[model samples]
Target: MTLAETLQTKLGEWKPAGDGRHSWAETFADSGWAVRIEADRTDTLGCQVWEVALDRVGQADASLTLSAWADRIAASVTGLPEKLKVVEIDQHQSAALLRSDTPGSRGNDVLYFEVRLAGLAKASIRRFKSEHAIGARREQIPFIITHEGLAKVVGDIAG
Candidate 1:
């Protein structure tokens, strides 16, 4: 199943997105946070990348370091792998490319996660077909990343 199809199954109803960049979008709003799951088609048609954006409804502590935010998120989101190694980190964002220690379980199966803080905090998980190193080129396989896991991420960020 494609990301859109899978998201529809998991998230119930989705409204058609008139924006050319996205095919469909669904949002879950709370007191101080809104999480949107979008079927991003900007990359390719073969697959739609699952783009989850977490928007803070109020003032956020922008002083926290990106790494600190990443750590807090990782600690709070129990669904994440036990040992998440930081593959990339900078002032604006921290990222972990979840690859197995073994070589065979690498490549397409690897999951990429990132927490980016600009004016708002955005957390996303995505997979690449050939290699994430290349880009977010869509793959044929369904997403191993779950909606429940994404909700945890949102909750962590909101907290």
Candidate 2:
């Protein structure tokens, strides 16, 4: 199944918000409800970054990021609900990498990239983890590299 299809089947009833700005899919299982939101971007290394945000019944929100690779795509599932563990797997279903420790409230949750060209090596994924103890606490966010997209913006620097 395609990435979108796999997500839709697992999440259910995916509806495009509009203009490819964002889309949402939802499903309910024995555990509770799972909602996945997909946002599109014209930036990066000619690749589309998919952000999968999941929320369970009476639980905190968690998210994962996946992107196309040179040969295959990589996916990392993190921010699991309390007592839950983080899982990472490659396209082959084999264990590529894993991190069980709970991530900070703000920072990169997961990141994947496929660099078919030699220029991507010089590029870097700039990330920041923010926290607001004053009023409302913010959550972690990630920014990935895309080909012919945002990555192109820094191609000269990368080269």
Candidate 3:
């Protein structure tokens, strides 16, 4: 079976958000976080993205929320002896991950770039939009990833 076929099989039960054969996306949301996986373009770009937002961090800095999650994903994905400095001198986790060649890194690491801020406030809420070339006045799609079932497929390839 193809990679997409394997993904579709693994995530057969996941809800869809309207992706076609060329794309796949999935989202997991809770009071504490929102996770989005968009990997349909991975095959061509050799990159897969996993996005997590800080939603209920009572006292955790939002960028730290990204840093913490990125650290977890990096450790899990790389099986490091200890978590490396995800936020490099550039002070950006996404940049570090993109440039890293950690073991088991098939260029499929979750990025933490959207939070390049110096810090995230405890009372502030920040969200980055996923835009797909809107016209002058078209209603923007909700935060949902437009692709439907491709996340599972991409996971098969990336996993």
Candidate 4:
């Protein structure tokens, strides 16, 4: 099934906000997180490219030890020894950014996952995509993330 179809089945009864197609959002109050997923474009591989962003709500502080959150997100996405590599990181007293190494690509355009911890106690998770304006793109999407995996990652962030 498509990512949207999967999400629709998983996020049952949650009225989607935003454009409702290419871009949309859902709030999971019980989980203390609001998620937005965008699938408006396609990548060079002709695969439908997408991103999922999750933000913590309320008074919770999103601060974390750089190495800890970095490892958590990286481990959550992959298994065993083959894992997401660290590309770059920018750390400050109140904000930080962590980018993982990109996957191989035919062109210079490549997408990577990122994590952001900001001063306002907000954390963001993103999977970047390099879009191609021309050529044929595939309809079968990649990246199958289980809801359990999401909960574990979000739980780590919330704690």
lDDT of 1: 0.45
Inter-residue clash pairs, candidate 1:
none
TM-score of each prediction: 0.51, 0.26, 0.28, 0.50
Q: Give the deviation of candidate 3 from the true structure as CA RMSD.
A: 12.6
TM-score of 1: 0.51
Candidate 1 Cα misplacement greater than 4 A, ranges = 1-10, 13-30, 39-49, 80-83, 92-111, 129-142
Local distance difference test values of all predictions, in order:
0.45, 0.31, 0.30, 0.49
Per residue, candidate 1 scores C-alpha lDDT tens digits across 1-159 of 433334335454343445544544434333445556555432212224355566655555768655666556555655443333344455444343322222222545444344444433555543333454556554533233344454454465555
Ranking by TM-score: 1, 4, 3, 2
Which is the better candidate, 3 or 4, if ranked by TM-score?
4
lDDT of 4 by residue, 32-69 (tens): 66666554432222212255566666555446455565
TM value for model 4: 0.50
Q: How well is each residue in 1-159 modelled by candidate 3, as lDDT tens digits?
A: 543343344344444344432233332222222233433223321322343222222344434554454454444433211233344423353232322232122143222122222233211111123223333232211122212233322222122
Per-residue lDDT of model 2, residues 1-159, tens digit only: 333333333333333344555644554444343434444643222223344333433332233222121112112221121111224434453222322233334353322221212211111222233343444343334344333233222222111
Model 3 weakest 10-residue run by lDDT: 121-130
Alpha-carbon RMSD to native, per candidate: 7.9, 15.8, 12.6, 8.5
Better model by TM-score, 2 or 3? 3
Off by over 4 Å in 3: 1-11, 15-31, 41-73, 78-99, 102-159
Off by over 4 Å in 4: 1-8, 11-21, 41-49, 59-66, 79-82, 87-89, 107-111, 119-159
